[model samples]
Target: MGGATTEPADEKPAVYYANCAEAKRAGAAPLHRGEPGYRKALDRDGDGVACET
Candidate 1:
């Protein structure tokens, strides 16, 4: 019984932003947890939302 989805091991790598500014510039600001380019460092309040203004 499979309950989880399977992803290709060679799938495109996850996105990463050095900082919120970078993310904003890339139009990926306000990233949320579980989304690509989302990091704890980006989430100042640890509210699961990153790069939020």
Candidate 2:
């Protein structure tokens, strides 16, 4: 008798793309300036906090 075969799981689930650029070009809020992965896209002066609000 042949047993049931299992397929590899998709490690990268759908949620992985939830916040990806492809998901929303607008992009999500940052984890506070000067933090990790803090792209200076908004902070022109690179001083963190775009306008010092």
Candidate 3:
């Protein structure tokens, strides 16, 4: 029998954005530090928010 796999709530998914523009276009801007698709590169000021204008 195969077991089901689950991801941690605090873990980010495979989603990724090369830049803020992409995130904004995708309507996923202003990503929190622990949110899915949120990356350190996106957080320019090292703040919790990402893609902030």
Candidate 3 lands at a TM-score of: 0.70
Query: Which clashing pairs does model 1 show?
Result: none
Put down candidate 2 lDDT per residue, 18-45, tens digits, no spaces: 3324323434333246543345564457
Error of 1 at 31 (Å): 0.2
Write the residue-wise lDDT of candidate 3 on 1-53 in tens digits. Answer: 67988899898658888899999999998899888889888888987898988
lDDT of each: 0.93, 0.42, 0.87
Q: Candidate 1: where is the Cα deviation over 4 Å?
A: 1-10
TM-score of each: 0.78, 0.25, 0.70
Model number with the top lDDT: 1
- Point out the higher-scoring one by lDDT: 1 or 3: 1
- What lDDT score goes with residue 50 in model 1? 95
Order by lDDT, highest first: 1, 3, 2
For candidate 2, the 10 contiguous residues with the lowest summed lDDT are 14-23
Instruction: Estimate the TM-score for candidate 1.
Output: 0.78
- List model 1 lDDT by residue over 1-53, tens digit each: 88988889889977989999999999998899999999898899999999899
